[model samples]
Target: MKTTIFTFHPDLKNGSRINASLAKAASEASFEVRDVYRLYPDFKIDVTAEQTVLEASDRIVLQFPIYWYQTPALLKQWFDAVLEYGWAYGSTGNALRGKEVLLVASFGAGAEDYQLDGRFHTTVEEVLKPIATIQYHTGLLFLEPFITTGTLNLSDEGLNEQVEKYLNILSAE
Candidate 1:
């Protein structure tokens, strides 16, 4: 199956460490990776182009670092713009039906901090619930997310291991 990854990092080429590495690995493995921020610096997404790519791919992976406990601004914009009424969610919107969406997120805090009584008082899955709910509206199958916690202190070896895990998921049927 054809899998396409949309990476949403505002400073992926510079500031990001984990996200950059992940994208690099995916690209090296011959996956179609689109750097969304770099593609639309002005935040003017080409809905037609994005929808075309999504339609062609069997799996759509959204890779990004969790910022403020949510996705970056541009990603939200992409969702609002690309997932239109008639094409993504209305009664006639079935263009994305049967497609699978996987969210790969990196969190600065450790996994321990995302529990019921943890620092954030919430789980990683809980934090991602809003985004996952997209499936109910669009018919896109929501896959269990791949999350890497404690990104702020992840070692090179750990990052490499995470990359391997991410690639394995992508390679899975």
Candidate 2:
């Protein structure tokens, strides 16, 4: 399958650790990795180009670090711009129909932090409900998210292992 990973890390090269490594692994594994911030430093997203890329993909992966329980700014902008009224939803919007979507997110908090009785008092699934709604409305299949919790304190070995697991996930059918 032609899988495309749309990574939305603002300071990807310098600030990020896990996501940067995952991006490299995805690229090496032949999954098309589009670094949105790198491409649109000015935040001027070209809707046509974005749509073209999405149109050619069998699977679309939205990879990012969770920020205040929401997606980063550019990703939101991409969604607003690229997923137009008559292209991604509405009666005539069928471009993304039948496409599979996966969310790969890294959380600084541990898994326990995102539970009913945990620190945040909310599950990750609850946090991701809006995206699931989008998938439902747009006719995209929402796959189970690939999440890495406690990212703030991952060891080198653990990080490498996660990278390998990501590669495996991307390679899976």
Candidate 3:
């Protein structure tokens, strides 16, 4: 199956560690990894091109680091611009149906900090509900997300371990 991972990081080359490593692993494995921020610094997404990429792929992966409990600004813009009503979710839209959508995200805080009684007072599922809703509306099959928390201080080995898991998940049926 053809798979594509859309990576959204504002400054991936310099500002990120774990996310960059993840992208590199996917790329090295021969997966199509689109560094969205690098491609569209102005946030002007080419809807046709993006939709084409999505349509051609059997699996679509959205890779990013959580910011303020949400996706980066450019990713949000891509969703708004590329996921059009008539093509993605309207009555006549079914292009994304049967496709698998996966989320690969990282969090600055530890997993323990996302529990109900913890610092964030929420679960990862709750934090990512909006993305799930998008899949529901678009008829895409939502796969369980791959998330690594406590990204602020992950060791090289720890990050590589997570990357291996990510590669495994994306490779699975």
Candidate 4:
């Protein structure tokens, strides 16, 4: 199956260490990795091209570092521009049906920090609900997410573990 991982890191080169490694693993493995920030720095997304990519892939993976409890601005912009109502959704929009959607996100805080009594005061599920909602809207199958917590200070082993896990998640049937 063709899997496409849309990686949206604003500072992919200079930011978090995890995002880039994940991209590299997927890219070197010959999986499709769409670097959104690098592809559309001006926030101009080619809806047709994006739709083509999505249509061709059996699974769509959205990878990014959680920013302000949400995906980066460009990712949001890509959803707005590319996931059009009449195309990705709506009664006539069944192009993506039977496909799978996966979320592979990174969090700066520890996993505990996302619990009900933690600093963020919300569950990881709560923080990631919108992506599932998108899956619903698109008539796509929603898979469990591959999330890594405490990205601010992950050891080399921990980071590699995440990269391998992410690769596995996307690679699975």
Candidate 5:
């Protein structure tokens, strides 16, 4: 399957460790990796280009860090601009139908903090409900998410392990 990874970190090159490393690993594994933030630094997404890429890929991976329990601003914009009416939804919008979407998210807090009664008082699945709605609307198949928690203190060994796991997910058919 043809897999494309779209990374949405605001400052991946300078201010990120986990996301940067993950993107690098995916790229090295021969998967197409697009740094959305780098592609549209001013937030001016090329709707046609984005949609074209999506149409050509079988698996779409959205990689980002959970910020304030939300996706990065550019990703929200990408969804709005790329997944349009009569193209990705509505009666004639079956461009993404049957395509798989995987969300790879990293959290600064520990996994325990995302429990029902944890610090956030919510689960990661709850945080990603909006994407589920998108999947329903766009006819995209939502796969089990790949989550990495406690990024703030993840050791080098832990990050290496996470990269290996991420590659495994990307390589899976």
Candidate 6:
């Protein structure tokens, strides 16, 4: 599949220990990764170019470090700007129909911290409901999301293992 990943980390250079590695692994594969912050530093989005990539892609991956349980500011702006009324949804919008949408997110909190009785008091799935809605409303196929939690304490070996699994997830049918 032709995959396009929209990576939304503003401090990628400083904070991409895990995500940056993943992006590197996918760099020459069947994927194209876009750094949203780098692309739109001025917050001026090119909706046409954005939509064009989305339309050409067979799979769409929104890769980011979940910020306060949501995407970073620039990606949010991209969504609001690119996913317009007559393109992504509404009467004449069918741009994303039959395509696939996925999210590959990294979280600072551990897995146990994202549950009903955990620190956040909600499952990661619960926190990700809005993205599910985007899939449902857009008539796109929703693949299982890739999530990495507790980034701070993972050893190099552990991190590489996770990256390997991530490659598998991307290659899986």
Total clashing pairs for each candidate: 0, 0, 0, 0, 0, 0
Cα lDDT tens digits, model 5, 1-173, are: 99999999999988779999999999999999999999999999999999999999999999999999999999999988999999999999999999999999999999999999999999999998998789888889999999999999999999999999999999999
Question: Candidate 1 residues 73-108, lDDT tens each?
Answer: 999999999999999989999999999999999999
lDDT of each: 0.95, 0.91, 0.92, 0.88, 0.95, 0.85
In model 6, which runs have C-alpha deviations exceeding 4 angstroms? none
TM-score for each candidate, following the candidate numbering: 0.98, 0.97, 0.98, 0.97, 0.98, 0.95
Question: How many Å off is the CA of 132 in candidate 5?
Answer: 1.8
Kindly list the per-residue Cα lDDT of model 2 for residues 60-154, writing each as its tens digit: 99999889988889988988899999999999999999999999998988999999999999989988888789987789998889999999999
RMSD of each: 0.7, 0.8, 0.8, 0.9, 0.7, 1.2
Candidate 6: give the clashing pairs: none
Q: After superposing candidate 1, which stretches have Cα over 4 Å from the reference?
A: none
lDDT winner, 1 or 6: 1
For candidate 3, give the lDDT of residue 29: 91
Task: Report the C-alpha lDDT of model 4 over 1-173, residue by residue, as the tens digit.
Answer: 99998999988988979999999999998998899898988998988999999999999889988988988998889889888888888988778888988888899999999999998899889988987888778889988888899989899999989888877777778
- Candidate 1 residue-wise lDDT at 11: 97
Q: Provide the lowest-lDDT 10-residue window in model 3.
A: 128-137
Q: How well does candidate 6 score on lDDT at residue 135? A: 70
> Looking at candidate 6, what is the lDDT of residue 139?
85
Q: List the residue pairs that clash in candidate 5.
A: none
